[model samples]
Target chain A: MIRKHGIKLTSVAILIAVLVAWEVLPTALDVPRFIIPTLSDSLAELQRMWANEGLLGHILSTALYTVLGFLIGSLLGAVMGYLLGMSKFWEKVLSPYILALQIAPKVAFAPLFIMWFGYNSMPKLLVTVLIVFFPVLVNVLQAMRTVDRDLVNLARAYNLTRLGIFWKVEMPSTVPNLMAGLRIASTLAVIGVTVGELVGGNTGLGYLISYGGGQANAAMVFNAIILLTVIGFLLYVVLERIEERVLHYLPKAHQ
Target chain B: MALEFRNVSKSFATQGDGELLAVDDVSFRVEEGEFVSVVGPSGCGKSTILSMTAGLYQPTSGEVLVSNVPVTGPNSHVGFMLQKDLLLPWRNIIANIEFGLEARGVPKADRRARAMKELDHCQLSGFENHFPYQLSGGMRQRAALARTLSIDPEIILLDEPFSALDAQTKLLLQNSFAKTIKDAGKTTLLITHDLSEAVLMSDRILVLSERPGQVIAEIKVDLPHRDQPIRRRVLPEVGEYAAQLFKHLKLEEKAA
Candidate 1:
């Protein structure tokens, strides 16, 4: 227990040292505030944005889009994955198109979506969906292909129906891969939303970042970036908790 | 007869547009409540026969019947156990044992009670709530046995079920499994490469030729102590039977 506590303390110490360096380094090197603002300057700008620029509204908008896009995209991806996995004929016909879509850069379509959907939230949500779709689809499909043949055979020996075999063997077998895909898509979700906002959005943290950059306000940009990181971090942590609950049967590996 | 193969033959299509014969005119019968073992070298169509009996594969020529009825597909009256336990990793032992019953749409409470009884019978009562990975290899195989027994299949098909276990675990499991099946009076067809295992557990041992396997010899194990398989290992008759099987296999190999 003491050793574990020491390890946690070391992690906190590293975080604190990085914070102290961020606070102290710029002034010591005589750097300009516009290039790299001090920690206090970024905090002061955060307060200013909260008071005058509706920072909470921007945070809420970004968070809402991130979550909405993640849910829709992941759901579509999982459905498509299971469908393709079960049907060889459809998979063969659609694989080339899927490959083409996967290879294309998702973020590059942000401006196209904005031009088509206008300056509202639709373009950002679309971009986020596009960005988050492929990882989940690929992971789930790979997992479906690699499910243990022996287990399926065993289920068949018991005279399990086609749907029963899928539900009991195939679906449960793909869960770990599905959860891994979700985790990857979770991080990509923020990137998708941010890219959409950076390109054309007027009401998100990404928009604040662009706006701050245009005005050369480094402290505001720093604050926006930190908030975006926090959002991504929180999402990742939540997914990790869900993964733990779902995969409790798996034995843990010790270092 | 609980299980019978009437001139059954199976052939698979090879990559070069050629047909490879597996089992060739194999004829045998396992009496009801009797233990029969098919001993053969590798690639001798031992597993193909079991698959046909289980109705997983169709015979190229003849028929495989279970409980005097021709097997059509996935025979409901037959329970199959492979070398690997093949327990679902996501489920606890009791749930795994209930899998077949659940697939048959048995009521929840009835399946649970049956599973618990099988677990108790297999000496795995306390490990019912543990996952497959949490148990030892022997315990996992016992759980598999419980799962197989829970379904109350008329004829149990064992495809070298103890082949993957260590030597000591193999003997112990062989003894327990033989005793359980005998006590329940279930007909069993065991396909194995182990001559000693055949002599120890089987009332009749069928020796098959190498490829395109046919029944080469039938040896009746007339030894006593059929329930105590491990003790049967010490009997002089066990070694003689093993030697007889070895000579048959060796003579077939030389002919090939």
Candidate 2:
């Protein structure tokens, strides 16, 4: 029991140590608050925003855009991956173009998306979708292609219809791969949304960071960054739980 | 004939290789309600025969027939159990057993009933809700057998079904499998590398040569009261059959 709790205990201890150092070091060293705010000051700033600055609204907006982008991107990626994975002809025909799109830096598209969709949430959503798309596509394709041939042959031997084979064999076999991709995509979705805010978003945690940097309010920037990190961590944990539940039957090696 | 492979030949195209013949003019007939085991060296096209019989592979030449009908596609009357149990990991044992029945459009309740019956028959009554991973190797193989049997296929193809089990489990499962297949009156074509397995379970054993496999010998197993395979293994004739198959396989191995 102690060993099982060891990691969490150590993490908490380290976190407290860091917070203490963050709070004490700046004032002890006579460092300016604007340059490096104390932990207390950042927390206070977070509270103030929560109470009066509509920070909750900003968090909700970012979450919405992130989830929407993640869902759309994952859906499109999975569909495209299924097509490419199942058909060698399509893979051969379209792989080069897909490669080019994947390799191109995503940040470069933010400005272009802004130009097309304007300064509204549309540009941010599009940016997030584009950023989250590739990992899901690549993972899904790899998973589908490498599905156990024996299982597929078993289905064929049973004289399952083409659709039946796909539903009963192909889909279930790809769940692990899809779950892995979705986990990755969820994290990337957060980053994608942040990047969008950094580039052109008007009211999100990303915008707060950008605004705080301009005003040299280190406390505000730290607060926004902390919240963003927490959001990403929570998203990852939830996705992992879903993965665990869905793939409960997977052997230990797979888990 | 419940199943017949008439001068069947199969070749696969390999990377940068012109062609690799796997089965060369192999011919065999499996009578209704008979259990025939094909023993050979690895890569001797033992599985190729089963696949062709299942209609998953079309022969380069000749034909595979089931109940006097040419197998143009996957034969509905055939149930193939692979070396691996190949149970759907996401499904429980009962669900896996019902996979073929579901594909055949059996009603949900009917397939469930059939699956439960097979599970009980396989001595896995309580494991119906358990996943394949939760079961032991022997149990998993029995579950695979139950799944195949649940479909009520006239022809059953077993590819090294008990090869992955422990020696004790193999013997036990083999006995039970022999009894089950006999009771079902299904024509079973088993492919394996184990000579003893062939001698113990088969009414007839077909020994095949190495790659580009062809029948080297066919020996009729005439053990008394063959239904009790584990008991017959103590008899002298089973050893003789095993030795005969070993000799034929060794000859092919040396020739290769």
Candidate 3:
């Protein structure tokens, strides 16, 4: 517990030091606004945009796309992964295509999605879904495959039905891995939405960043970037908390 | 006989090779309520024998019977405890112990009652809600044993179930396990690499030859108090049986 408090203190101290350096360094060096905006300028821009330019609306739009895409992708991936996990023949048959999709860079598809969906939120949501799918599918498949054989055998010895074994053994064992994949996918979902917005969207933090860059308003770009970072951090923290609550029975890694 | 292996043999198919013989023409019988141990050198197919009895493996050649019926597949008549405690990490101690009953589809009330009784018997009454990770190794194994017995199987197969424990814990668990089996009057077959554990726990011990394993000899444990593991370990009779098993295993190893 004391160690945990010490770690928290260290992180806060480091953050403050970084923030001070970011605010002071540009002034000391007399860097141009377009090259290196001061921290104060970014914060002032953030306040101005929040009060007058609908920055909150942009944040909400991006968040909606992210959540929808994450939910659909993770659910569909879990189902597909579970089915493939149980059937080796099917997995062998379909794995190559899944692998191909996984290896092809998702960001490269953002323009194609925008072209197909015609400059709307649909393209961004689809991009987020596509980005979030593979990690979950692969992780769930691997988790199912790696379930301890002894436990399965025990279930069989006790005459557990096929479905019973799946419920009591396979499902619970896959949870930790599934949670790991979801955590990664959540962060990726945010990135995917940002890419989509950069390519074609009219309103979103991603669009704001792109617009700010086009106009050479460095403070506006920094404010948008800061918002994106906060959103990503919050998503990660929520997932982590859920993982902790669900896997409380497991031996902690440090132990 | 509660369990019988009639001229049983098993072989495995190796990749890019012909059949690899595991057990060779092995025959044995475990009488009702008997505690029998099979001790052999490593890779002697001791575990194969247990798996075959549990119907987890087909005997490649001969037959395994339980209660005068030919064994076809996993049935409710037998329980197997593996070397690892194998308590599900997600389950609390009581829940782990109730697994077999749950699998058998016993009523919730009945399952809870049986699990609580077994937990008390294993001396883990207060740890009902503590998960497997929270327990010590000895405690986990005890919970595993309780899980096995919860279903009231007539025959129990133990595959080196205590081999991972420290010497002190091993002796303590063995003494308690022997007494529990005796009190319950269940037929048991134990597979072990440890010679003294066999002598201390078994009413009779079978020594097996090296790979392509077959029964080489049988020694009836003549100790007066078989349930008392610590005392049995110090007994001269225990030493004789252990020495005899060691000598036979050594000879088999040299020949192989």
Tens-digit lDDT string for candidate 2 (B79-187): 9887798888899999999988877788899999999999998999988889888999989889999999998999999999888888899889889988888888889
Clashing pairs in 3: none
What ranges in model 1 sit over 4 Å off?
B251-256
Q: Is candidate 1 or candidate 3 better by lDDT?
A: 1
lDDT of 3 by residue, A153-239 (tens): 889988899899999999999999999999999999999989999999789999999999999989998888888888888888999
User: TM-score for every candidate vs. truth?
Assistant: 0.97, 0.96, 0.96
lDDT of 1: 0.92
DockQ of each candidate, alpha-carbon based: 0.78, 0.82, 0.86
Show model 2 residue runs off by greater than 4 Å: A252-255, B251-256
For every model in order, what is the iRMS? 0.9, 1.1, 0.8
- Candidate with maximal lDDT: 1
Predicted model with the maximum DockQ: 3
Q: Comparing only chain A of model 1 with the true chain A, what is the TM-score?
A: 0.97
lDDT string for model 3 (B1-256, tens) is 8999899999999998889899999998899999999988789899889888888878999999999898888888999998899999999988898899886668999999999999888888899999998999888999999998999998999999999999889889998888888888899999998888888899999999889899999889878777778777777767777778878788556878
lDDT accuracy of residue B154 in candidate 2? 90
Which CAPRI category fits model 3?
high
Over B1-256, each residue of candidate 1 has an lDDT whose tens digit, in order, gives 7988999999999999999999999999999999999999899999999889888889999988887899988857999898899999999999999998988889999999999999998999789899998998888988998999998988999999998889999999999999988888899999998889999999999999989899999999999888899889899888889889989889556778
